[model samples]
Target: MLLQLDCLSTCLTSSGSVLFPITAGGGSLDCFSACQTMGYGQILHRHGNEEDRVHLNVGGVRHQVDPDMLLRFPHTRLGRLLLCQSEAAILELCDDYSPAEREYYFDRNPRVFLCVLNFYHTGCVHMMEELCVFSFSQEIEYWGIQELHLGPCCGNWYHERKDYIEDGDWDIRSDDQQHPSLDSSFEELSALDKDLAKFKGAWCGDLRSYIWLRLEDPGHSTASKIIAVASLSVVLTSIVAMCVHSMPEFQRVDDNEKPIEDPVLTVLEEICIACFSVEFIIRLIVAPSRRKFLGNPLNIIDVASILPFYATLALETADEEAAEENEDIENVGKVVQVLRLMRVLRILKLARHSIGLRALGATVRHSYHEVGLLLLFLSVGISIFSALIYSAEREVEHTDLGTIPSGWWWATITMTTVGFGDTCPVTPAGKIVATLCIICGLLVVALPITIIFNKFSKYYQRNKAMEGQFAESIDFMSSVIISTRTNRYQTDSQDVKDVFFSRSSCS
Candidate 1:
């Protein structure tokens, strides 16, 4: 700004010559007179870039620099100042400028300036080991050097710091403590917060809130913990029932040779579904935001896991009443089977009670991009190999693949390394293509898996850290949320309640 002001201050007279230039007379005459009083006027004419060396006293450290050499990068802070034609021009660049001693004093950090000085000669900016990435960046910014100028050796440290600040989960804790738009001292914070606050906590609903805490957060109370345990037990029973009745030992054949459903497992499933239905109803009634509760993915999972049973019942009743084609009945049965399979999603309900499951949930939520990249790589590899393999075996008489479309199934199974063997390469050429596909699959799959695993670890570690901080509160159950923190002693814990609210993603 000072340099810009100095440039803009220059004005033209009617003659249109360089009248009232900052280095010459007029407004600068005072600075020139002060120099004369200090004996600077005598040698002012000799003060040019051709001088042998310029003396500098930066933050108490003394140095001698060649004036011409400093002009190598003339756009920088010191470099721009060296362009000054007179002692008056150098006034803006330095403090305590003494022409008699021929030294310029600067209050800036002596350590970082050394790096700046090195850049003038070496044409590279090196970050100091003692300075943090942010501090080093600030110094360089002040010196008019781009952060991109940092050498490759230390670039990772700078880039890593930048990336972490922008994207990492490490800042959640501090962020929770510091309310957005309310960093003022206590009295002002209270005043501002009170004005902006909403009345949505447990106090507003009282008993409903109490019920919500129990059903939602096992850590809230003994009753809630018991409810969580019961919920978990019911979920396990439902899952087990779904699996067990399919076993040959549990099967019963009717007189017509139709398979009869196990009566005991049927009753067990009903009981579990009943428990889930009741729990969902209670949570829905008490949840601060019914829409948000319904919107929550875990809650959606709960509904998904429960609705299948009721739908199956409805379909079974319809089947008895309607005289439909056998194929149509089979299709309805398939639909019903799909609904039943949705019961498997009930295991995600366990995320409500276990931090590990919740962390896994969060990992999946955040790793979508990496997952998409993995899928994309797989798609390209699959398409290429499918075409290559089909072309290789197309002439073969007894090839498993009959068409390019058919190779899709082969390619999918092959790239996934599942190798169902139902569709495979018979020709040696196709086999070689299969080999390359498998290798590419491994590389493609491994890359995303590592990233997803890292995200899982981050969420898991973060959750564990929170659990450690609130060991007493989080011991029995998971409440809800990703990237949220809750202070248990707050006037109402629900002020920042999780949507599933373990608020492992809690605040």
Candidate 2:
């Protein structure tokens, strides 16, 4: 008999029925306990009685609904609770239901619940005229319904609500206000504030945000573009000045004689330096964290490039004084020349503003493993070929490849196909080794180039796609704002006309 009762309980539970044990005396004991344990026992009892439909009380409105209809959206929170097969709590008074009748209570807006009920019946929801998109979306979310379940009209409104939320335009306090005109204007201003906030750093009152946007962000703002163009021009001009300074005409003749610096180049250098120095100083002063700013490799490069100019000037001054004192100053002048040459490295600063150059840098960084493998293969090939050539050419008189180290130079040139002709393997065996090195070089060099090129293409394509999406989103938002303003203007004009007609009729 016990085994039979256990089998009966399992069969009833499997068939979506509430499990309550029956006694031989025909009296139900622990019914409340069984209902509480089942969680949806009340729903199952109300649904089982086919003679009477269940009634739902939602926000003071009575909705007489077929119990089977509630189970239509079984995947949702409400449906799952009322299906009797799930563990979700349907009500706090689960044990208070009478055997003859039951009424479920819910404290949700009837209007939103109506839409939800319609969704369960027809697989679609329609936002009513009296309901705003944001409020309706909130109800939909609470009901565990996805936004995509809405129709086209509601779907568009849902997307707009999402945009507004992402832009931080919603105001909790304004929800109680009834003035649509004022609220719309306030939301527009809030959206503008959100856009402007992107130019700012996380912390308030930090000027580093503005500096960073102008320097790093590739925004379409006029100020940002102007800064980028000016920075690029400065970098190019500095590079040109360095190149001109390196020409033979600019070289000094003797320790006593001074170098004839071009006045035009000198003026350009000073201007570029002044611009860079001011920018660097402003960045340092406005930086939120001094240590982080100093630690950045690009910032360090900027400082390194700028310091060389001052060092060159100081060294030139010392060299002049030493020449006047008839002291040895040739080495000091050479040091000054080296310092001036180092300033040419400032050309790298242009990469910060150029997307193409930045993409190339990123490609190289991401392809490090492929590049390392190619380099490793090349190193092994160079070593093997160098050893072979050293053995082959060691017997020849007056040969550049007489030692292993000297043979390495020949191997490198041969593999690169540079054929500098300063060193060559004269023996037949050495020639064969040199040929093999050249073939290996050609194969190894192609591998890294292929990897880097693929990376560059992928990054460039992703950037273009992101730019397109950003532009499309901006255009869509602009159209929404323009339509909103047009509607407001029409409403105001109608209100003015009504006021004039009412006064004329009274007069």
Candidate 3:
């Protein structure tokens, strides 16, 4: 006679409780009844007075739970798997039991199940100190728990494990006993590393890889290049439009004058604004982190440049309305003109997509110290020349340099060789000082320019070399793949030939 060791009965009591029996040969049914009374194998029925109750047998341990509570975390696999209404495969076991009193068994870690159960109940998951992060992560995945749903403790553990994996702590191996050659292994490793980097970057929400490929990478796709080119054209057109708008001929006749609109310029301005606004908004939205996006100086410039266009429109409308209402109302056209000048800053956005501009920006950054020193020297020269001219021209009557402030302006213009002729020294001492200032200006301007140019050239060459190396790496990877495929084909052909000979000999 066969002995039944563990059997779950489909019987339901009058009180709506399931009975499960753990029996051996000729064992008393009293033991099973005793276990049920001790709450070892009881399944609470849905129609019972205990409406939200459920009884689970996990790792041979009885757990009383609330189905309503577990259903709160519908995203979790366990939550769905345990619920009667869930369509998960794990719930199919319920069909073996009576619908009035369902009893299900799961060979799972009771301790871990308790932790998961609590998480569903409390929205908090604590990582057990004894359990390794890797093991816990596996269990979480098995349970269909989302990483985002992890509490702070488990979340940190997950990130630590993620970082370890990304840092190449894991080993890569082939299933075949005959290992690949050194060159092939190296190529495989390189490809794996690249793929791993992309995966990690995406997981961390770092948009750098995506942005670089679309906007900055030298080997840009056709669509990306088209976008870049179109954006460049719009930016250039905007600059030209602003220039034309600033001309004297484009100014209104007076504060009250109704401005004549140029259809072409208006349409062009709108198009440029629309393009820039769309680009800015798209980048901002797709950025991995808003803080990181706003932190970039170039991104800040992009937003600033686009804002003035809308401001100008608003100001123009207000100015037109104010002009008609009151002659005393100040014309905001001048202020709008000043704000429109800021649109010129959009030209800097080219640096994001253009190699030459990027190199130039790098050059400037690298030469910051050198530029600072040059400015220091220029400041000293300006101060000395201003003092001398002020002292000399102060004694002279009817001179623009009669005051120290005026003298400073004269010094600036004279030293830069920008003689507007509006202010000039009238005395012998002042003339000598002005001559010295002009000579100093030439040296000061040329020194910084020469230093910047040298730095720019160096960085430009470095960038070119890096691009060349990148292209070579891509070609080498392609060649490796082709060779590997060829070798695989040859090995398969040899295996087929040997098999054919063996069959013929057997025949």
Candidate 4:
């Protein structure tokens, strides 16, 4: 389908001379697209025109694009630009254009234009990682492309940016306020003051915001650093108490012959739980979004670490005397103790502070496909090898490979090459099967490990990149901001509009 050119009447430069290219000497222009042509469709000759070519200079990046491609979206500036069939219309696009060259120039970001160019060819928009999402979003609006037109890759990034911005992670500023002002504004606002404001977030007007900042961001202030250190200390103390409490010396037999917990260890764990409970409450209270705070993984870890302590206490208190006599209560107590092991997950809480730990976490998050593939490979190998090894050893008497399930354990151990020497085949056929299993296991395991490692390297690089680039993006935001002070002007505004776009689309 072709884009309806209702605005064809609005194309100012689309007079006869611009419809087709011509040499300065007055012969028909000769040009060809050396770039790989893509897709299959009659869209190229939809209008019954043979071919229309343009020598377009976007900023400094030049491209020989088909006019028919531009015509696919008639409402866009390029469509209107090429639709204008006159040489003068192309010249008006930029002041520095040399009429003798016949190349239309437009001063714009070449990186963003790459994306726009792709869109004209592909009909879907994408963003570049090097460019700020804000800048990209502005460019999309300028190009008259709706957010719905974003490709799947860029769409995910755009939505993530939206959620993050709402949480006040980024400062949403307009360019109208960034120009040099020597009077009341610049004199009153110090550089340090501006920097602090940028980090202070959109919730600066509220008193709770400062408190939330202290708890949420350790880099916020000295108080925040102290808070981080104190929280880490408490986590370490709790782990130590849990460990010491499990020691043999800490176990004492009471008068009733029931083992009792060491009071000192119990007291230490109680103190740690109390600290965790108070901090979680304060964080939940002051958080900007209660839903986001509650849903956070680290926050969930905090809750899990605290609940185990209380549940264990409740079960122990339910019937202290009945514990030795009642089987149900003893089994229930064992289950509660198992639940208490969830406290060990509290170690993951440090991911909030450690960049390396966060990167590792992200690596695990993104490498799930590889992880699944590894499991699938192992499952198939275990099933096949177990049966093969069982068939080979079943003929022999006094064999350790007694059954298929037993062979499963042997096969698992052999595939991993962790020969415990506890269960192995005495038969040559079984040994041959074990050798084959080991070789297959190495291949299956190595492939997924390589994929997962590559993903780790990728995510780690992105995590590191975000740290250095966030500040640069904030600074660059000023330069790209839309302002009425822009140099370009339009007599017929509806005919054309400025658009920004660029590159290796948000991969």
TM-score of each: 0.62, 0.50, 0.46, 0.55
Best by TM-score: 1
Angstrom error at residue 391, model 2: 2.3
lDDT per residue (tens digit) for residues 357-462 in model 3: 8678766655667778777877788788888888888877777787777777887777777899998877788788888889889998888888678657766775
Question: Candidate 4, 256: how far from true, in Å?
Answer: 1.8
What Cα-based lDDT does every candidate model obtain? Answer: 0.69, 0.67, 0.65, 0.66
| Error at 11, model 2, angstroms | 30
Report the lDDT tens digits of candidate 4 across residue range 1-507.
Answer: 211232121211323222333335432222112101211111122244333255578788877776677778877766656544344554453444443454567777788889999999899988777787777777767766778889998899888986666433212132125343211222323432343344334454245555765676565458878999999998888888777777898888889897787888878888888898999998877775668568766788788778877887787777565657664554875777696787787777777767677678756765567788898999999999999999999989988886899988998887777889899888999989989999998999899998678656755665566534433443343233222214323433523432212222433
Cα error, candidate 2, residue 130 (Å): 42
Q: TM-score of the candidate numbered 1?
A: 0.62
lDDT of 3 at 130: 77
Error of 1 at 321 (Å): 7.3
True lDDT of residue 307, candidate 4 = 86
Cα RMSDs, all models: 12.5, 15.0, 21.3, 18.5
Judged by lDDT, which candidate is best? Answer: 1
Minimum summed lDDT over a 10-residue window in model 4 is located at 32-41
Pick out the ten consecutive residues of candidate 2 with the lowest summed lDDT.
91-100
| lDDT over C-alpha atoms for residue 356 of model 1 | 96
Error of 3 at 62 (Å): 70
Tell me the tens digit of each residue's lDDT in model 1 across 1-507: 453234323422222123334564354555334333332222222234434367889999998787666666777776776666556667776777875666789888899889988887888888777776667788788878887777788788778876775456443333454334222234333432332222234345446644654665566668876887888888888878888978999999899897778899888888888888888898887776677578777888888888888998999878866655443455877887788787788877887778899788767766667888988998898789888988999998977776878888888888888988887788899889999989988888888899789778888886776544443433322332111225444525555564445656565
Q: Give per-residue CA lDDT, model 2, range 200-293, as digits (tens).
A: 3345433544555455444535776788788778889889888887788765554657556777778889999999998888777656566756
